[model samples]
Target: MEKNHEFIRYVLPKGKTFSGLTQAQATLIANHINSTARASLNGCTPFELALLLLDRKLLELCHMAWIPADQVTLKPTLLK
Candidate 1:
């Protein structure tokens, strides 16, 4: 979260995708999420969220992981 704070354009409430990002920067965000307090997420980890999405192709776990970050913001639903 703090990683993107420098780029308020990404969290503009209206969102701003397609922005420039490096693999290292992405890893920073992932690590930040991994190190944060996730007990409020029903005992699930952020990596698990990504794994589940790839395994089940569903966003049903968004409530447990948190929206817009846990899952892709694309409109083309990966799961019905």
Candidate 2:
């Protein structure tokens, strides 16, 4: 999907290859992304919405966590 591509581009370092990205780095990025509030979600973050709607066990199985809104980081420094 185009959004997925955009997210990948947003998270990846400029001029860097995604192939070099590690799983831990990806997880960190993912957590930050999910923690971000979106207009599409009426300003509620994906993590908050998931916690309200999805089963807690399922969330735990996926290793998802609620990153505090103030702590969310979507910049290149996040992966540094």
Candidate 3:
């Protein structure tokens, strides 16, 4: 809380790297949220949440970009 969390609240980052704050402040928030959320879970950190979020988003994007296939091809090997 020495740098950023000294204040009661903060705005989420608008871009990469949790911008517009001090490292100590960012660390404090990360630690608190990790501890609390982890305790509630069996010991999982927010990083796990982030990974799950990324996977879900990727799956959604893939589904959006999916295309119908005209036919299937079975290839044992490619010939030179």
Q: What is the per-residue lDDT of model 3 for residues 2-77, given as tens digits with 9 covering 90 to 100?
A: 3233222332432325455575544444434333334444665444555556675763443322112222111111
lDDT of 1 by residue, 1-80 (tens): 44345433332324545356555444444444443335655766565656556653343333223334445432212212
Task: Write the number of the candidate with greater TM-score, choosing between 2 and 3.
Answer: 2
The residue ranges of model 1 lying beyond 4 angstroms of the native Cα positions read 1-14, 40-80
Q: After superposition, how far is residue 9 of candidate 1 from its true place, in Å?
A: 11
**TM-score (C-alpha) between model 1 and the true structure:** 0.32
Could you tally the backbone clashes for each prediction?
0, 0, 0
- Per residue, candidate 2 scores C-alpha lDDT tens digits across 1-80 of 35545666676756978787787787777788888788888998888999999999998877788789899776677888
Estimated TM-score for each candidate: 0.32, 0.79, 0.27
Cα lDDT, model 2, residue 35:
82
Q: Provide the lDDT at 60 for model 1.
A: 33
Ranking by TM-score: 2, 1, 3
| Candidate 1 vs 2: which has more lDDT | 2
lDDT of 1 at 32: 42
Steric clash pairs (candidate 1): none
Q: What C-alpha lDDT, on a 0 to 100 scale, does residue 29 get in candidate 2?
A: 79
Tell me the lDDT of model 1 at 73: 31
